[model samples]
Target: MKKPLIFVYFFLLISPVFAQMEFGFDDKDAFSPHSIRQVRRADVMYNNTVWVRMDLREKQNEPFFAANSEITKIIIDAVKAGVLRPYKNDSLITRMSIQEFNDNIKIPGADEGLTDEDLAMGFGDSDFGGGDDWGGGDWGSEGGAEEDAGPDEFFPNNIYILELKEHRMFDRKRSRMYYDIQSIKLIIPGELYPTGINKELATFSYKELVSNVFVDNPAAVWYNAKNTAENKNLADAFELRQFTGKIVKYSNPKDNVIDDIYKGNLKLGLAKSQEYEHRLLEYESDLWSN
Candidate 1:
């Protein structure tokens, strides 16, 4: 009886180690209480991490892009309000300062060639360049000051794309699969840049967004077109998968996105993305088969 009691105590002490080994997760990777369907790592039979790109301009995703209450607007406002912290990337490990976030969203070269004193002296005025016949060379034209008069800032509406990093895992204990979202990233479309380079504004932890930012914030809403009264919280909308997104990347040893794998061939990349989707469905179906 004494030997059996000692063995039981020893097993209890080592159980956590076994759990870590089974899932390759440390305590830091434990599921958050706010997670939709909190499944223990040990219960995850299979896991696939995928990156999805959501185009808010899409008809199916318009609810999230509603005029004033755009999801991007809400997030940006929250960050500005100091209520939400942004991350450097989807890893969610490094925190981004508010200044850094602001810098990233600004239209590149928009503020170039203009100083505070220049604006105060009315050097930016259109009339200053036209009426003045001092040198007759158009000072603004020589200095390219006219280009600086373009839009100096980017609005939330300009951010029409969002990227999500998530893990789709089959929880054998629950006999179901779960979409465990990790992070949400705001993307500045390539068209917005002169060089056609898409810029990542910042990444927000999905757990933090769901549990704190969107959960109780009245401003963060999913606009309901049919009935204004039926508008739901952004958190609920995400859980319901109301937005449609394209799968861009899945777990790969080389960590290449579909476009890269397909060598920038849009059609092939799209087809491969669909294939991955079908594979997920087939995997779930096969789980119940003999």
Candidate 2:
């Protein structure tokens, strides 16, 4: 009887351990879609999601926009080839079809009333000047009716802004903090549009990007200006954080961006963004305190 009671007590004491192990095994992939590391939910002591905006035209980010192998071009081509899945937003819940992706990236008035043959002819002076009526027949009229010349479609260079959504978390199991990127968004600058409102093309899962798009592609390169032989894969460049980005927002109760919180004061918002960066660094140090 004494032996049985001891065995029963020991089982109860170790039951929680077994339960924890099972939970970790089952839910290890919960964050896998967005994170390279398999972090268990129970091990996450703290978490904060942040949004960052990167300007590819910036000197520090020029490698991502290198000639002939721009990151934007690689991603856009992959989407068009049906090899990548685009999301409607950073939530990654809803998927945007290929048609939707195309429409989003297209310029407002591009390709309007233009046929394949018209496109093939090219928008050249010679092509529109051979007519005998009013130096190309009124220039803005077709078949005795006025016509509007639509705006041109977007080019890879026009997509200069990249938005990243990532979670900064402290994992108790690893006793370290991790920046787990979730999604990336492409943005056409507001200046490109008449209304001056920036347009979001589409969001993509970083998991798919790292696994499928950037991993083995030869064209996805991070150009090395100093050393021609030292060019790195885009995936490795991202892992090294070889780019500069400004924090636009962080996890907050109101879901407000830095600009919104500072009432659109650009200087104040920039300072606030810096403050948040410092706080994140200080947080890890604080955790080590006695």
Candidate 3:
């Protein structure tokens, strides 16, 4: 009697599956369209590549070590100590800091040997161009010309401001010419989360797994190139202003402006950079969309 009961239980268990197959409920044609394999957006999954353009003239110069360029010895030391990592490809590398980046960066008062006169603005070789960075002007004068600038204008005061897209703006209200970061291709790392059953079981696996598993796979650079024999990384590339950035790849390589193809393209600057990066990345992602 127990054997007969066991047989009945087995028959009941397999009957529905057999019935479903015979009735074509599990037919290949009945599969949802959503179940069909779809192509993946590699960038969405692996956000390891970046093309960045830093404007060294946009942000305020660090009062400590960076004046003309942010790539100073202190920053370089930090890179060497693994507080920072510069990348050229997938490899997080330590390249020799170019001598000019180390020696030529003009920190206001960091160097003991630099004389006040040496740092002072003298009318010496206006042989190239005459005047302060803004234009010919008295350095400490209270007023120059009080004119309201358009939304995109550099400065309201100072009758003459460099209007070139590449020029740095003078914030006359603050009496300061804040520095800008230059452009580069930086491969910033992605966020890490726990995997498998550990997601609920472990409290600290994500951070620990990332630190250990990706110790060799840290954020790095992508397409920053060094045509010169002098080895340089993303930091060095931006310090030297090595890259010319644009919203989209120029259809014509000879065209100096990226606006040729991307009509009405906004000029590049340090401000609104995150907005620009996001919108551009979206443009790239849209190509993969149905």
Candidate 4:
């Protein structure tokens, strides 16, 4: 069971966003398809560790925009040149406090007894990367779907928020410059249980099974990516900010023996999730269509 969960978590952290985004360029200018802007993501091993940087032009950055020369590339290039580094490794990001976690992370039937202290403590000890994992414990089991929606839980799971300040475009020849700060939230899937009883059950044998059996629910606790533009007017002059993320392949998050969730190692895990998500969406659509 732990093996599968570990694999699934990897896929969730690395998979790219395939949905097409609309840049709202008159609804007819297909040239301005949604361009990915930020590419940073949280780490599964380190609580505050960021896996990637926001600039779109890095050895790690990939295509984020539908068009050829989107700002994502520009940002990436800047990162390579030391012009921009929106996210860093050593920096400490301010997140929600314990009270905020309860107010925001609680699921529909989540045990009220569970507190933020419990979560923080769990995170501190859960072998984030040093090979000292408390496998088969509550950290991987409790807090189901609700964990996926909230920022505190999800961001730590590999999703990240990359903000760009004072972004502007100028008609250099015309001597006019417009500036605004931009924020992008990117959802990077991490080690999470998808929606399926068999998948969850497979993680642990009957002997390893405990009171809280993980269900193979995709929404159980995953991350997502997004992009927001503060200055809408700049869309015409420059471009709407974007977010892009990627997943790498590694043996483990634990330094000793645990493997890190990376690409290519979790194909089947993702396929199962896709099938499950498809059925669920179909079922919901049918139910609502009536």
Candidate 3 yields a Cα-based lDDT of: 0.28
What's the lDDT for candidate 4?
0.27
Alpha-carbon local distance difference test for all models? 0.77, 0.78, 0.28, 0.27
Q: Write the per-residue lDDT of candidate 2 for residues 1-290, one digit (tens) a residue.
A: 69999999999999878756755554444645467665888788899999999999999999999986788877776664445778899999999865566567767766665677877766311111223221233211111212222235467778899999999888887687888888999998999889999999999999898886787677779999999699998889988889999999999999999999999999999999999988988997898672
Number of the top-ranking candidate, with lDDT as the measure? 2
Instruction: Give the Cα-based TM-score of candidate 3 against the true structure.
Output: 0.22
lDDT per residue (tens digit) for residues 1-290 in model 4? 69999988886766443212211224233211121221111111111111212433332222233232233222222222222223221121332232332332223234444578866665322121222221112232222212122322322322222222222222222233322222332222223325321110001111111112212321121111133322122132224223333212112356221112333345654454355436544644554464
For model 3, the superposed segments whose C-alpha errors exceed 4 Å read 1-51, 54-75, 80-98, 108-252, 255-287
lDDT of 4 at 93: 35
Q: Candidate 1 at 160: error in angstroms?
A: 0.4
- What's the TM-score of every candidate structure? 0.76, 0.78, 0.22, 0.19
How would you encode candidate 3's per-residue C-alpha lDDT over 1-290 as one tens digit per residue?
A: 79999999999999877755553433234212111111122212222123233223333211111221122222232222323323232111333232222222222234344466744543121111224222232212211111222222112111111111121222222232212221222211111112211010001111221232223321212122233344343333333545444333212345433334344455543334445556645654553462
Answer with 2 or 4, whichever has the higher TM-score. Answer: 2
Q: Once superposed on the true structure, which residue ranges of model 1 sit more than 4 Å away at CA?
A: 1-37, 113-151, 288-290
Best by TM-score: 2
Point out where model 4 deviates above 4 Å: 1-68, 80-83, 88-267, 275-290
